[model samples]
Target chain A: MAKKSIKIRAKVKEDIVTVKALMTHPMETGARKDKSGELIPAHFIQEVVCESGGKTILTADWSGGVSKNPYLSFKFKGASKGDMVKLSWADNKGKSDSVEAKIG
Target chain B: MNLKRRIVLKGTAAASAIGVAGLLAPRAVLAAWPEAAFTAKTVPEALEALTGNSAASESGDIKIKAPDIAENGAVVPVTVTTSIEGIQSISVIAANNPVPLVASYNMGEGALGFVSTRIKMGKSGDVVAVVKAGDKLYSASKGVKVTIGGCGG
Candidate 1:
C-alpha cells in the first residue's frame, strides 16, 4: 500500500516556527482478520520522530491503540522562516516514512 | 452433459456466496479493527509503551463528547476538546481493546484544541481522551455500550 500523505500547517509565532501535522493511516491494530478467519498480525506506527533543521524536537512511541489517521500538533522552538521540519514514523511491519515541510 | 452443467452452476453459487461474505465482514469490523487493542489488564503494562508513565489526570477542561450507546460498533464518532491554552495534543484510548490508543492529535500553535473522528470500538468499554499541553497532561472519558460487535455479528 502507498504511504499516506501528511497535511502540515506551518507558520511563525514570536519568531519561532510552529507546525501542525496530520497523517492519513488506517493504523490497523493487527488483531482484525481477513475473511479467511486468520488473525492479521498487528501493524501500526510504533515510533514517530519530528526534527527541525537537523535537531530533534520530539520523538513519540505510539501503541497500536491509536485510532486511524492520527493527527499531531506540536511546536519547535528557534525555528525561523525557510527552515525545514521533518516528520517520520516506523510501523510495526518495519515500513518507514520521511516527509518534510519548509517553515513559512 | 447434465452433470457438467450442474457442477458449473454449483461452483458459481459457491463463489458468489463467498464474495458476499467477504464484503460484509470487512464493513463490520473495519470500523472496530482491533479487539485485543484494549483489555490491557494492568495500567503499568498498558502505559509502558507509547508515552511512558501516561498516568493521566482528569480535569473539567478536557471534555470528551461521544454517544452513550453505540447502535453499531463499526463506526463511533468521538470528539475531544480542551479549555486550556498552549495546547499540544489529544489521544483516545480504548481500555478494553488489545491495542488501546485510538487516536492521537498534536495541536500546534493557532490550531483549535478540538478534533472529531470516527473509530471502530471492538466492544463496550471505557473510552479515554488524554491531552498534553506543555508538560501537563489532562484527560476525560465516558462509558460506551457496544450493541453489535464491529468485527461481525
Candidate 2:
C-alpha cells in the first residue's frame, strides 16, 4: 500500500519522545449523508500502533466517534534522538497503512 | 462516477486479499477487535465485552482531565493519567454516545499509564476513564458539556 494517509513527527526532549500524528481520514460516522443525501458508510480507523526503537510503545483502538481527520499526541520514555519511530493504522473495513519517522 | 466504481471494486479485492493474509499471521493477544464491545450501546455492556467483567472500582489514582464545557462537540480534548502500577490497558468511555466505548489503549511493558487524545461527543455526558492494572480495573470520570455535533446520537 502507499501508506499516504498518515503524517507523523517525533521529537526527543529531556529523554522523552513526544510523537504527534495527523491522520487524513473522512471518519465517516455512517450516519452522515452525501450530496445526494445517501448514507455514508462507517469508515474509520479502529486501531493505531506506535513503535519506538523496535518496541511497541502505544496502541489505540478508536471508534467512529472520533472526529474527522483525527489528531493524536503522546509521549514515551527510553527513546533518544536518531532513533526510529513507526506508526500504523487499521480501519474498520480492513484497510491499513503505516509510516515511519526518525526522532529528531 | 465511473472512477468511483472502479475504486470501490479495487478496494474490495484488496480487502479480501488482506483477510486471507491476516488468517495466516500468528495470533496475538487483543489483536482482534471485540465487536460486541464496540457495538454495545450501554456502558456496562460495553465494559463487559472488553474486560470480561462489568464492575470497576472507583479510584482516585486515575485522573481525567477535560474541560468543564466543550465548545465544540466535534472535537473534545481528553487526557488520562494514573499513578497505579502494572497498568496494562486504558479505555475511554463516553457514557452518552451511541457507542459508549470511544477509545481503548494497550500499554506496553514499562510504559507510562498516560494518554491524551481528542474524541467526538454527540451530546453532554460523563467521560469515564478506565485503567486495567494487574487484573483489576480502576476508573475515574468527569462531566463534559457539549456545545454541538459531537459523536453519537
Candidate 3:
C-alpha cells in the first residue's frame, strides 16, 4: 500500500501552531463482522507521532477502539510559517505511513 | 515489517545524534510501549497495568469533552484536558468497546496535559479519561450514546 494515508494541515498564529490531521483507516475493532457474519480481524492504527522540524511533538498509542478514519487536532509552541510538520501512523498489522505538511 | 520499524528507529536515533533545537531535544528516556496494558480485559486491569492504580479518584479538575449523542460510533471526537500539574500520562477508555482502552499518551516534561482524538464505540457507554499525576491518578467520564454502532452494530 502507498503511504498516502494521512492528510494534514498546520497553521501558525502568534507563535503557536495548530495541527489537524485526517487519517484513512478502517480501524476495525476485531469485534466487527462482515455482511457474511464473519468476524473482521483487527486492523487499526496503534501508534501516531507528530513532529515539527524533525522534533517529536506528540506521540499516541491507540487501539481498535478508535473510530474509523480518525481525526486529530493539537497545538504546540515555537512554530513558524512554512515550517514542515510531519505526522506518521503505525497499525497493528505493522503497516505504517508518514506525511509532512508545511505550516501555513 | 521489521525492516521498516528498524529504519524508523534509526531515523529517530539519527535525529537525536544531531542534537537539534530545544523543541527537538531527545528525551533522556522514552518509556517502552505497554502492550500488556492495552490488552487487559477490564478497565481496572488496564489502568492497573498502565498506572499501577486501578482505584483512581474522580476529579472535577479533569475534563472530558464528548458529544452526548454520536451519530456514528465509527468516529467520535473526544478531548481530554486537566488542570492538574505534573501530569505523567493520560488514558482514554470506551467502556462498552470489546477492548475498552482506546488510547494512552505519555506526557513529557513541559508538555501540556491536553489531548484530542477520535475514538470508536461499540455501543452507548461512558467514555472515561484517566490522568496520572505524581503517583496519583484522577479521571473524568461522560456518557455517550451511539446511534450507529462502530463495531458492526
Candidate 4:
C-alpha cells in the first residue's frame, strides 16, 4: 500500500478510551485560487469511521470547511487496554486510508 | 482481423468497468454521506438538509469551547460537549463560512457525547453546536472572532 497518511493514538483510562487522530491532507475547498489564478478543485475527506472489536463507535461526515491536516478527538467506553481501535477516512475523490492503534 | 480486434477491445472495456465498480463498492457499504447538508450555504439550510428540521431550540446543556479570538482562521480549534442523554449526533457549523456546515458526527453505542476538531472560517462568526438527542434538536453557539480569513488564498 501507499505510505500511510493517518496517525492515530488510543489511550484507555478508567474504562474510557480516548482516541486522537491527525490526518495529513490538503483539504482544498475549491473556492481558493492558486498563484497562477486558477481555481483549486475541492478535495477533502468526506467521511471518517472509528471502530473497535467489530463495532463502530463513531462516524464523522466532514466538508471542505474543515481545516487542512484535520485533527479529531473523541471518547468511548467499554474498551480495555490492548484492544485495537481502527480509524479510517475516505475523501471525496474516492481515496481512503486507515490505521489501527492498540489501546495503551 | 478487424472483427477480432473489436472483440478484444470490448472485453477490455468490460473488465475495466468491473474494476471501477469494485473500487466504489466499499463506499456504498458505509453509511451514506450527506451531500446536501455539506453544500448548504446557510445554517438553516444545512440543518434542514441534515435533520429534516430547521428549528433548533437553544439548550444550556450543550457546551461549545472555542477561542474568543482566533489569530488564524485556517485552523480554529473547537470542541462540543453535551450532557443530554440518548445523544444521536453532533454537528458543528461555522455560520459565516461559504458552506456553513463544517462537520457532523454520529455517535454509536458506547460513544460519548463529545467531539473535538478544527474548522475553517471565512470570517468572524458564531460557531454553532447542534446536538440531536431523542429525536429533538438542541443547539448552542459561541462567537469566534477571526483576524485572518481561512478560505482566501
Output the number of the TM-score-best candidate. Answer: 4
lDDT of 2: 0.79
How many times do residue backbones clash in model 3? Answer: 1
Model 4 misplacement above 4 A: B1-31
CAPRI quality of model 4: acceptable
Give the lDDT of residue B130 in candidate 3: 95
- Model 1 chain B is weakest, by summed lDDT over 10 consecutive residues, at B29-38
Question: Relative to the true structure, how large is the alpha-carbon lDDT of every model?
Answer: 0.61, 0.79, 0.77, 0.87
Count of steric clashes across candidates, in order = 24, 3, 1, 0
- Candidate 2 per-residue lDDT over residues A40-90, each given as its tens digit: 567778789999777999888887777788888777789889999999988
**Model 4 CA lDDT for position A53:** 92
lDDT string, candidate 1, B1-153, tens digits: 366854554344334323433433332423322222232333434444434556777888887788999887666777776777876666776665434565555544344566655666767887888877776777788898978644221
lDDT of 2 by residue, B53-119 (tens): 8889999999999999999988898989898988889999989876778888888744677788788
Candidate closest to the true structure, highest DockQ? 4
lDDT of 1 by residue, A1-104 (tens): 47556777778778656567777766755545569865455555656667776666665545544556666655556778888888887665556677888888
Residue pairs of candidate 3 with colliding backbone atoms: A67-B120
lDDT leader: 4
Give each model a TM-score: 0.57, 0.83, 0.80, 0.88
Model 1's lDDT to the true fold? 0.61
Mark the regions of model 1 whose C-alpha exceeds 4 Å error after superposition.
A1-7, A12-26, A73-80, B1-39, B42-45, B48-57, B65-91, B103-119, B131-138, B143-153
Name the 10 consecutive residues with the lowest summed lDDT in model 2 chain B. B20-29
Worst lDDT run of 10 residues, candidate 1 chain A, spans: A58-67
